[model samples]
Target chain A: MSEERKPGEPANEISRRAFLAALTTSAVTATAAALSPLKDVVDLPTLEEFLRLHYKELTPEDKKAILERIAAQVEKDYGVRPNVTDPPPIPGVEFGYALNIGRCIGCRKCVYACAKENNQSRNPQIQYIRVLQMRKGSIDVESAKTDYEGEVPKDGFYYMPVQCHQCRKAPCVKACPVQATWQEPDGIVVIDYNWCIGCRYCMAACPYGARRFNFEKPEIPKDELNPEMGYLSNRPRPKGVVEKCHFCLHRTRKGKYPACVEVCPTGSRKFGNLLDPDSEIANIIKTKRVYVLKEEVGTLPRFYYYFNL
Target chain B: MTLDRDEGSKRIPLAAAGAAVACLLALAVVFTKDLIGKGPGRDDIPKLSPEYADPSTVRKVRTEMTFDGAPCQACHEGAEPLQGNPHEKGIFHEHIELKHGRNQHCFNCHHRMQPADFSNFDGSPIKLDNIQLLCAKCHGTIYRDWGLGIHGRRSGFWDTAKGPLKTQVCIACHNPHWPIFKPLKAAPPPHINPRTRAKGGKTAGAENHGGLD
Candidate 1:
């Protein structure tokens, strides 16, 4: 027994010594490599080049620099410098949408606001919202759906507001190959328009059919433009990318309501914290029978609906 | 049996347990209150479909307040669009009076007629389903543009490349009667109740949201 225990001692000591020696050198080398400053890579050629960098790869300073440059360029383009993306102290803002079916007049104002908010061009072609006029009790999405005519809503029909539902459990996020779109902790799903290559994968993934593709470059008159824009929500999206409603993250992050919700003349839209047990929306949902558009699909859409008695 | 029986007799049983419980009862200091009964499901949202007042979500009512020439339904010419070929004839070069001209707004065409539609100059009643025929009377260029899927919406089952339009009807996106157009996908926010929610205010020209006069 003594021989068995003592005979391997030298071999064990030798291997342990070798392992420690190798570990020490690698540790020292790795520390040195990581601590080395990357000074030369900071100074890039141009703002357009800076804009081309992926959002995640940007450092705090780099992000700030990029935002400032973009804001300045926007001032030059539209003459009205709107506030660009400012990092919010509160994280996990998931945007939610709710529409009052009773109050919708089908005037197409929300669509126009989306265009202005997102800096969509004036081609008069992009449709961000689809307000359908339907005869009562019609559940068929196609048959009940009617477009805007000069006469607007006719008698014996209720207006059903339709748009990107901003689902809590969005399938579009899973379908993206490049992670171009993601659901924010606060509950809104957004696309990294720059990162998107116009694959149209998201369009197929969406059950509500909320995403829109720019068939052509947007054509807004030079003077008629919204300058201050959202980074992911409303910045002038390039052609061949998918876009959807974001609950106006640029406005909502600052505790301001979205332009669409604010522009609605009727109190048809309700926005509040789902986590808060005391908010008006929560109370309304608690006291009344609240329902989502398609609860069956398990999208967990933040948009809720309850009719007024 | 004698030794086991003696140990069993010495063992503590319910008597000791009762004594321990009695001692702990002084510390328990229990209180009593009425139990609240619970029911199924929550009621938080203000109302539901059957209860909601606005019938727009259920049945649509045409707005009366409108811009000029707001009765495109009065111009439905009563012919299915060029059956099967997806193309139609143009009329703009043939008649100046039939042209969309300058009066082109939703009110000029696409206007919802209440209880009745208007008569054309020939004293013929306008049709609602064939508003495109009225536009073909003047806007033949636009008509061809629509037919080739260039001027208007190019939408349908297989071909989604050129037009966003799925419909061949001129007033499908445009106001066929007077002709100023709003994008069909643009949804105007509703006039919401201030006591509950707040949607946006007036969009587009001349907020004509009344019954057709």
Candidate 2:
């Protein structure tokens, strides 16, 4: 092939051009070969989706466009079109959650209710609430058993369900290398799932162990997908992001009680505005000596625990 | 002689300056200790909205709400309520289980003269809508807590001006006859954890979701 070079051109020049051409061709082939290995991974996110700006940085128009794209993508993937929206926080409202440790019967009704309300995955089972069956006279979460299959409200055990406390001084928010997770004005610690880089630093930073990472694509039944979704709340998240309880912002922001709070047969769960003087949580904090979990750590979790007695 | 006199004057001022510096340092140390000892100052506890009851529960219970099947006037209109256990005859009151504290007779909760309504602490006819008053006769503390909107769950808007707030009535959750709630089936426990994957376990499916019982 070298000997068959065209006549009338400088032999050295022709050889140099051929060498350069071969180098360029090989470089192209090598680049293609490298990208071929990532074909499965790179196929999901479009270039526009991958280059999307952070949630905070998005303009109204940008947000609308991004949301539409995401909704379209979700519809395509899950076979359901979710109303993924970011609703404004209610004015003069600051959310607070309380649990009556005395009344909790260890029935995980709140857990399943939360999963169903938040549109969580069923097969892989991403549950936001974990009912810790702790022994009486002990508040140590480290020793609390979560896998107890026996009759609940067991002889010596009391149930304490733990979820995202939505701390005022959220360590998870501070730990996010990317500003993906943040606290809303209503005191809900929310995650912009699309913006999370999946560093798992926030998971390590959380003292309550409230955060859950999507190890694989969250799998939900087609009919189970909640059509009502808050943009920063229960919107179906992609693989490799962190998720947690958002005080059911999707429902609560719309002037509705959280599903968990409504389903609680014993009325152990309490939620209201911390700023409001007569709110149920505030009354509990005022009248009942409400204590927070891991208070020495000073995370200032909005979740309070109290014995009605 | 002039230079020696200047040095002598400088010595007094330098000693005075040293004393002042020491005093300032002592003040700073004392203030720092005082601040540290005090810790985070009392944060202004925010005032909550006045309406604290569960909006949904309160909304669901109408003031004139009647219990299913049996009306208060059904027996109280013509016949005198039978004394002692209504179920002692074992005819119509088979479901009546007096699990409430200490009371044995039918008239403990019911008025002797007026069998149509419950009795209050003042022995007045307590309407069914104001059952809290009837419960308050014994459970004063719980009644107080309920009044403050903490003992029971509240639903609806925290801002009452925005929407109606509903509180769960005493009978909504507690059975008047039994008083104590029966334990229903709890939701499934979490099967997966941070360390479970290391042990090679999978998520609990439908077969393993419910309790062992």
Candidate 3:
């Protein structure tokens, strides 16, 4: 084949080898140039994070190490040492929330309180609760307004504040491609932020429109950072993850009312263990004209909306 | 050619029908003027009374008066205790606006003789500590709800086994004189993102959106 080359053509063996070498050099250089932007990425996962196992698969020792790493990262990022813990769900306790639609004044106190407690982004705000001001005669949420100004409990209109229903049949959990989110034994739906791939599949799956995607790095002020953080609940979430109301699991798991419940001036918000027969939530469910948001969809939400009258 | 002419002629009746329907709708709207936008107006809705017997203010006054060891008796010891309506202008306690519906008599709630303690239905002295009993006289359902941790604010813990739960007294949230809760200035609305502006310049998911985005 080399001897049969045209008069102007080089020897076949030598020319072919040189051409192959030139192609590889160009390919390597192009690849290096394309990856050059990666150098500016300050939050690239460390080796431990890259090799981390799934939340369920992590051993006790692995969890401890990971928690410590998270604490350190939070400290470095926000200049505050967060007390992060992964509290297991209390046995025989299925958490439930009850809101009195009759009494809710649409003050949005709960909305702000939740944001403060959860360390949600301030600039591009990410509040979990949306208080819809609806006309009194109708239950049509589609025509309700959220951005009403001035003093609330507007005449001829009632406020219906909606948050994560923490559905027993959570569509978000089922839609998560990586199983990063799931319902806890206590019936609170939680997310493993570290494991989330930010595909936003869960956001699309949620019927309540409860899921919020972090389009930019969450801008929580250092002073406003909730130091009492839960590993699976309100720990500072990284950019490109989906978050929703975790029922303030950090506080709720430890037997405290969620921040929203605590701040409600009208005493419209009620929360307690549904399993306990004498609990306030149980009483509200048994006595009041109880209803849930979007009941037709069959989410079986633990959150109950009720009328006192 | 005949079919084309027939199709063209059919369009005129359809246009007339459309015009007739539009005229009917316009007339219907004119006739239904009162029905449209007939919701409760600002004037029709009862204004929240400005007189609020703020629990803190009441506490402050009680403490200041009792600081000298004798409360109302300090002043009333020598002088004759004036009777009749306590809310009348120029009366000693005229500033206390009795806005609580229908329970007008001052001695109905307050002890006429002692003036320091609350009065039960039979005019017996009820201690200040048992304020729920006083409010429970009229608001029995609220009293029941408060006991079950449904009506009023609860703090500290939801699980009694794990921690202590503290339920606020009725007086802590509502004033005894006014009784009704004062209207609160609502917190600022959620920040609207510029990118998600839907039609009418409202946030895309402003209603029932649960602050997604």
TM-score of each: 0.49, 0.75, 0.78
DockQ of each: 0.03, 0.10, 0.13
| Residue pair clashes in candidate 3 | none
Write one digit per residue (lDDT tens) for candidate 1, span A1-309.
Answer: 111223434322333234444445555554444434344253333756535667667778876876787677667766777677844423533444556675565666666656666666444245456676677775455554433444454567777767788887898888889888987777778787767878888888877767777644555555656665777777665667888887777766766656666444343566655665544455556654567776789998888766643
TM-score, model 2, chain B versus true chain B: 0.55
Of candidate 1 chain B, the 10-residue stretch with the lowest lDDT total is B204-213
lDDT digits (tens) for residues A1-309 of candidate 3:
213333454322234334344445555554554555566688889998999999999999999999899899999998998898888898899999999999898888788778888888775568788888889987988777777878777789999998899999998999998999999899999999899999999888888878888866787878778899899988988889989999989898898888887777778899999999999999998878999988998889998999986
Judged by DockQ cut-offs, is candidate 2 incorrect, acceptable, medium or high? incorrect
Question: By descending TM-score, how would the candidates be arranged?
Answer: 3, 2, 1
What are the per-residue Cα lDDT tens digits for candidate 1 across B94-181?
3223345666332333323331333344545455455555566567765653453323322121112222313335544343333453
Interface root-mean-square deviation for each candidate? 26.2, 27.1, 23.6
Give the true-structure RMSD of model 1: 24.3
Question: How do the residues A1-309 of candidate 2 rate in per-residue lDDT, one tens digit apiece?
Answer: 213333564423323334444445555554554444365583376888788888778899988887787788779977888788888788889999999999998877778778777877654567888888888998877667676664567878888998999999999999999899988888898998878889989988988878888866777667767878788888888888889999889778877778888777678888888888877888888888789999999999999999976
Off by over 4 Å in 3: A1-38, B1-70, B77-90, B194-213
Candidate 2 residue runs with Cα over 4 Å from true position: A1-38, B1-90, B193-213
Candidates 2 and 3 compared: the better one by lDDT is 3
Which candidate number would show the highest lDDT if scored against the true structure?
3
